[model samples]
Target chain A: MKRFLLISLIWPGYLLAQDNARQIEMTQLLLIKNHQVLSGNKQPDGLAEHSETVLRKAERYRYQGDFDKAVPLYQQAAQLNPKRQGYIGYVHLAFLHDYSRAMQYLNAYDALTPTFDDIEGNNPVSYYRGVIYLKTNEFALAIEQLNKSIGDIERKHGSEWVNYRYYVSRARAFLATSQPQKALDDLDKAVANYKKSALAYYHRGLALVQLGRTAEAKSAFQDAQFFFGAKRVEALQAGQAVIPEDQLFPLYESEIEAAIDQLKLKP
Target chain B: MKKQGWRNGKKYALPGLFLFGFWLTTTAQPLTRDQLTGQWIGVHAELNNASLCPLSTYLDLRSDGSFYLGMVDGKAPPKVMTWAMKAGQLRLDVLTYALDLISLTNDVLRIGQDSPMLFRRFQEIAVDSTAAFQTLNGRVWETDSLRLSLFANGKLLWENCQTYEQTVHCWQLARYGTAVFLVTRGNAHTCEGDYKPLWQLTQSGKQQFRAIGWNGQAVATETFRLVRPLKLSEMPPANEFQRCANCFDGSRYSVAEPFLRRYQPMLYDIRKAFEQYYKPVVASGQSGLVQIQFAVDCDGRMGRFLVKGFDNDYQAKSFDPQLVAQLLTICRQKLPAGWRRDPLTDQQQSDIDVLLNVRLSNGTITDVFL
Candidate 1:
């Protein structure tokens, strides 16, 4: 960070010495005024309209998975109006999935704002890293993180997605590393969230293989195939991506390996 | 309550996803991993404890955390409800059959109201009931290590040690419970070869041998717990003696061959090592009476062969003691798997008896004397 600060200082033809000092002073003043000066007040009508337009365009690029295109525009909107939570939230969300990266945006968010936007905005980065744990193979840890994600989410919206993601993720973890039977029990509950989930069958197949029922594994592979062709096709077309069975199972990995391989993929 | 915690988390993340909402509608594709989730195989349940122990059985736990024995005696239908692990303690229970042997009380009280003691014992009296069941009746096979107990009469010796190589004595073995114990002792006049007990521990509050000799100078003192072999299909490939992790750890492993002596005060003619590499020559042709004197060492290695009466120039005859020594060394290294090394003495000394063989052979091995 000192290196970046030094580079920012020695850089030629960049923001002038006074311009840099002026910008820092402006940021401090805005924070002190609690955004009252920035919002519900003196902004020119055209400035609000322009910021809104830029925010929408940035979000659209982000939706298309064009992070590079979205980053610069989001940065522009955030610099133009540092009070908008959505601007920082975009970067923070991207970093959240990769526990290590989430920390970076979280630090930026805390440094940039005096009052955090969401109730969870002021939370420690470990809490968000725990959210990343929800997606990892360690189900026990995932439960712990999602449990923490629960209270804040409840204070904001209701429970549902956190619970579902946690349950499903824990189910996957159990099936991947723990005993097949325990995983099966958890999947039984997870399938109820949306029903028709192939993960339950895949986990059941893994249990069967451990139980030495080869014939049952064959049936499970077939059922997994059936669900991918039907329920999962839409996800692929959307580019949100539900991993195809072939990629997850690429070779002769038994049904269990395929499931974990699929779950482990980065979004 | 539907979907619950993830819903709340997603709500916090909702503002972030607002940008991707259009993408969600655009792709219209479902995540395939989530779809195929049910198709994955279940991971095998591993117990936190026995995962490291060498025990063959597992503690089968129910959904409520009640336990049962899994994988018993290599039988499919596990001996149900035999014993259980509850609250970090072992509870043993067995079904009883009314078949009578010599009657004895099942439990012994420690003469106090609170001290209830349990005893489990089995005894077999011999009436000359013997049948050879081992594949190697007179032949010898090589192994990396061996544990043995030396006995002069019926009483066991305290000095027991296992060697990676053969020393002097060897003796025939007698089976004792799940382990094999030496039934005979060798001569003391030869090189300092004798069955020495090496490692000892207390089992059932009494001094017990960990590895003990099963033959003449044979010095094994390991506790060989009875276990059903894993299915041949599941077993790892057999490793060579040289590839063993402990082979290079200074000590050599060897095995001893114990035999019955017909004309001696001693009970066994203990051979230094097994004949895994080359066959032992008990003398072939042109002999009235052949005399062979051999010595047993503390290391269970047989050496110093003096075979008498081969009239013609001898063929290239080599005593396979080196191979036997190697085999004994291998056995010594591996035989301590279930052993409890005696804490006292820093494991420097052992009690062992070495048997020296003096043989007179005509064609077949002559009356062997120990």
Candidate 2:
């Protein structure tokens, strides 16, 4: 029993070290990869430090409500990182609220990174690409991205290591495609993963509604009120079945909020 | 001792403050509400020739933001119209009557004077109508069972027909040998339900002339002119001349037929193309009418045609709105001297409406400018 306890305690540290090393290696590869694709104002920035500074500067501009200025900085940072091009380009594409362009960036990211590789476990970038696809209502592509993110994390750690929001988002994306049956299947598994999340119930209800399961759908939407706070109105009642003009932005803000919660990241 | 003195001074100051407040209310600058309520005479309503009409009316402005136009009576109805006061100018939204009264400077109601009265058709009262108020009209009148219009203009327009790019309607004319008698229509209203033919005041003049019941022939006539069509406030004086023994009634044959048969060579070509493009609503119909609205730009060239609605007496779908749009496209593409653009005056901000009466036969359209 003592030996097992010792092993369990050591396992987390060993795994963390492995992750750190991988992060460093990936950072190096990111810095060296794809030197081409740099824009007009971004050339000859003596690599990583300059790129980091540009990213920080972009963040500052973003703080100042200068989205136009900030986006280019983030884009330059990604180009410099080379390994980050896949994720960084995707992030800029997504946050800048250009969905079609974000998809273009996501496609580039997907091609650069192999389909089988497990990079998204610690990388928030892969999850975001799935989100972009999900927002565009590209269900097949979103599922593909989410599945890869899940598969990578599972390989790195275990099935339990998969990001909770990825599963939830996958389900939501499924619903967006008008395939409530498939989405319901995802939600059933999603609730199993994180029953405490109100989103699981709320989304399950939405899926049920789409599938014509009115009673089940109604119950889920009511339960979701507990998870989503005041924002459940948009989901509980279809506020505006309006089409979204900004492609990268989530059609429903609730999904973006839920994603931020699962990622434990502040936008 | 000093504290007691300061405390006593506060009581003395109270009466002076109360007196000041009373004086403010009594001396405030304002004209009486009644003075502001009546028809403040500003602009005279006139015919299309810009000749002032003899009748006059003022607008009644209420304190509650509702508006009433001047009628002959002293009392106004509950609400005259949806009115808004913008920058001292009165804005009246009219729904059918082709009414416009622009008040000049003298007729303007001074801020402190009696409520201004707008007297329509009064030259002096309507002098400032242009300066203080602008009125738009919308009206619909009917003929016998047919809803004919008095001033050749349609009763209602969706977009500000005045403001939109191209809005078209139909107008017909008559041909007497080489003499082209440009046709004008009087009110759809009649003593007994009958149509009347009111022709233009010669080729140059804006006023219309009425024809004493004529030898109503079945000659084809189509002429559509793009000049600003006039909206008549009253019908022309009815002539007593009548023929007892004739199939052509003064109302129908002398008026409606000649107006409908008025032909345009180019518009007819477009209509013919429409018939060829779409199966005619009336099979074996050799001739069809394409009722279209187009813009006449500053140059004499015709602008595009946007059709609001369409009706075909024969089952002929030749004059479809889509086909009209295409015909208008061709007109813009081909006609150089067709559109006209006037110098930038405060008045002429957009192209004028041109209602073309077009005929279709063997894939060709003849358009008459009215």
Candidate 3:
């Protein structure tokens, strides 16, 4: 009877201990999920240090093209420092192409930061916004934002500060809206300003073809091929400017040749 | 007293049964390190929600106890970390994510608490690294629905037999340690336009290879039998420009330029007429470029006039074909009256292709050029 009583008394205490342990484990799991270390040295500074370490690791992963790993780390960093939202937005937009997620991060960034005009200088937000709009097929919005970015750069730096990317992007927007003549003009400006850009020449060829200037289109395609070939060789040697191979160019020499052939057949 | 003790034991029987069931559910059979080695692919079951698209996840457990967790699709790079199993739980040191092991047998690994995810091992074939690229070059690899051809000049032709659509893409070979990646661009059909899929090339058998998708899952099983070897000399040059014989040569169209220059004295009249016709239709505070095409025939008559506005159709409904015709009519009316036919070269006998660009800023003509 005494043994049974003792067992009964200890069993309740054991159950209580088990419950407490389970609670502690659950808390620890939650903390880890939130990117917090469950050490005695836990402090605000420690959290910051942890965030920094995670950010560094994430950047390393990004540099090594391990974006799957980098994205989670970036999310952790953004949670730690809300200011990292913009950078995370750019990564999601440019690398992942997750437009909705990118827009969420960008919206978070916009909520945290001041407006573009109020910032008193040139910022890349407008440019990034323009690119996002372009990718989303909001052509008018893309042009408006891109124009603002170009105007800001021109106002702050000079006309020389207006890079070819802005013109090329705007040209794409023009093309999307079936304004081939305007696209051709912007492409011409892009080629004039940055002669080394194979993208500009490729776009120029598309615009020329749209405008029924097949001969000029052929010339532009040749220029695009020359520059792209040279760049590919240079990238192989120098290991710089190496874009993802699949994203190198949608159109190839055979496609360009086929386009030229089609034009030839068109009376 | 014994009967009383039996009654007490019977009173606690339900709780004991519950505790035993909980233990059985939580505590899984322990897995050995050796059993975990090699590549394992699984679906990310956590994203089971309707809005979330589950991707294939891969776990490459090396014999050395190091692990790489990533997608098989080559969309992103793998995460390198150390892994350990303890007390029927798997722990990843970097991620700090731990899951209770449910069961592991026959190359299938299941882990989780409530909803367990399953992973399967891939049957790997040893590949000869040196001859892999050489063997793959200039060969057509086909399956039931897909045909792929890789050229030496970095061009890849992919044809989808089901869709009957062919896409020309660029390819590059990159190596990191023993892993060889065949990176292909422009294949993804997504809202973000083109996406590059970095495929890990592994030779499965003699003249056969497997392309692992970004989700760390096997996407394609391809077999290659070399029909013809590609010679660099035989490959078509990328820069071969094809010119149509009857196409307009801009340099030979000199008469159109001189004609525009001679009409410069009437620039003010032309600008005024253009502004009067287009000012109301052009949006206020918006600037645009307008290209007007007209033929100055051998008889010197201004005819075949067409106007093209730079503004996108969606932005301004007023800038339509009718507006273009009206603008063209205004230009023709504003042109100088008489023109003398220039001496025709054999190459330049047609109606001259005269393209004039008129720049308008906020409903006023800013500049005009050829």
Candidate 4:
């Protein structure tokens, strides 16, 4: 079976070689340059643009740690295209761990549309900034930023319309600030918004533990364990992206189990 | 066609003539010095059937039996070498290539057997450099089609003005005879594989400059008028520009043949050797994956042991210090027994990165992936 699988993997290489055989011409240099800048795994000539093509190209360089090429391309894309600024900021905060640069881009993006909340990829720009502040341990700033994403929506359209992940993010900030009651309030709303949210149950367990509700905390942790497993299987079966809340505040299956194990030993 | 004659003695005459013709085409033919004397422009090098590395390097084969191999842009220094056709084989410097492997057809020269490099005869077009430089240097130029900024420091910014999309590159003026070619290529951060475009300057003035070459698609004349002088602060971003960026940097070494196949028995032996040396450190909260990556040179010497750990979440986490130290010690000490003095090392041409990902549960090795 292993031998067969290896052969299957290598069979495409021969097909690829046969497919790429073309008569060489001088004009094909344009095609070569286009290939290098677009779909190639090879190094690019740093031909940046303020379009989707350039943004995707910059992402490739950034992922490969080719920061010299990546930085200039990203800067150009974000500077020239106002809409791309927030997206770049989100990528910096989540994947690159470049907090300062993320803040800079996010600030610039927010300035463009001050009155309205701006969406960056799947989440709001303020939500990404809140996660960045949380990562840096600026609990107060994190909560303030989170409120702009969650509170503003809750005021206009009520809590039901807001994403459950936003509440979970704010709840994490509340927990960091030792505001257990506020954390519990947000987690409850998060649970109400999405009943099967493992993140909500996990944070609820944390808040309950903080408030000395041991039995309830244990139950919340059990619910978290059940939902976490279900979510993992669902994501695998459907090929869905790993739960987005995990990018902001990681919640592992082992962590929930560890909490349960610790609570069991507390007797 | 001669099958009936093959049964008779007369068949030998036809077969002999065919053999002679094949020999003439394959070996008897010798390439003349005059045929290869002119400048050749690089096209593309076929590394394999699937891959083509774009070539900007030109070969200037002088009539004096000497040659210069370098970039067409004149950005890099040329390498001078002596060339001669000896015994129907082409010799450049100390390297000799088989006669059958080379072909010159319609002014295009194809060289080499395994990885064929193709080059076309260059036509030197004349244009005044002084006037071109006067219009180009330290100024921003804009056209209906494109936007270009040429800095005095030899840096350039090119943009598709129609779409407001831009790219940063290095530019230089090369004088081929009386012609001034505006050469634009990748910066230091980019690889040599990046394509370099040579634009022939056709006309130039204080207000406008015209060039005919690759306009991102086909060879065409593009006219640009002066927009403004480049500010002192404007320059190509040189932050973290590595002269030669490591190709393997930030990339995981995939398990490839013949490293995995030809060395399968050796790899199995190495894995067995690890089982004997690795002593699992039993402790709580140590369950996850640990990947130990190292490089083994052609001489069977091992070095650069790097260890990375991830918890159940797959997030970057450090394993227990003692556990990590033990793994490093095994890699540094015990792993060499399987590699050092191995006969397989003799066949290797380059150093290869080896990876071992181990799954641990409570610090006990559950599985090992080579």
Considering every candidate listed, which one attains the maximal TM-score?
A: 4
Docking class of 4: incorrect
Candidate 3 residue-wise lDDT, A22-122, digit = tens? 32232223223323222323353656677776776676554333445666788898898776778677766654455556777777877775664322113
Q: Write the per-residue lDDT of candidate 2 for residues A1-267, one digit (tens) a residue.
A: 453344323322221122212322221121122111223234545787677767766755443324446667767777776555555555445333445555555555556756533243254556667777765567788788788777777778975656556677888777777878878877777777776556577678778767766666656765665554443334335532222222232223344344335333322
lDDT of 2 by residue, B1-370 (tens): 8889988888777997888888986663333333345444222221211222111123456667676543222212223556544443444443211111122333343221111122321221112222111111222322122222323343221112233321122223433223222222111221111112222112221222222111112111212222233355433332211211111111111111121112121233444344454433332433444545554432333535444321223232544444566556545554433222211111221224345445454334422322
Residue A253 alpha-carbon offset, candidate 3, angstroms:
5.8
Instruction: Give the Å shift of residue B81 in candidate 4.
Output: 44
TM-score (all chains, Cα) for each model: 0.24, 0.29, 0.34, 0.42
List DockQ, one per candidate, in order.
0.00, 0.01, 0.02, 0.01
Tens-place lDDT digits, model 1, residues B1-370: 7679889888879777876897787753422212211111101111111111011222332433233433212222343344333342223332211111111232110110111111112122221112311211222222234422222222221222344432223234443323232222222222111222212111111122233222222223344332222222432222211111100111110111111111111112122222222233444442222223332232333344344332212222233344334333533432222111211111211212122222222333322222
lDDT of each: 0.33, 0.41, 0.55, 0.65
In order, the candidates keep a fraction of the true contacts of 0.00, 0.00, 0.00, 0.00
Q: Model 1: per-residue lDDT, tens digit, A1-267? A: 453334323221111121212322221221122211122233547755666667666755443323445556766666666545433553434321222333444445556654543333444333444444543345577556545554556567754433333344444555556556665555555555545655556656666566566676657656655664565456545643233222111212233445545434523
Best by DockQ: 3
Tell me model 2's lDDT, rounded to 2 decimals: 0.41
Models ranked on lDDT: 4, 3, 2, 1
Q: Which ranges in model 1 have alpha carbons more than 4 Å from their true place?
A: A1-99, A103-131, A134-141, A149-163, A175-182, A203-220, A232-267, B1-370
Candidate 4 regions with alpha-carbon error over 4 angstroms: A1-53, A238-245, B1-370
lDDT of 4 by residue, A1-267 (tens): 464345334432322121111112222322222222113333544443335566765765543334446666777787667777887887766555567788999988978888867887777788888888988889899999999998888899999999998888898888988999999999999999999988899899999999999999999999998887777567656754344345545565556877899888886
In terms of lDDT, which candidate is stronger, 1 or 4?
4
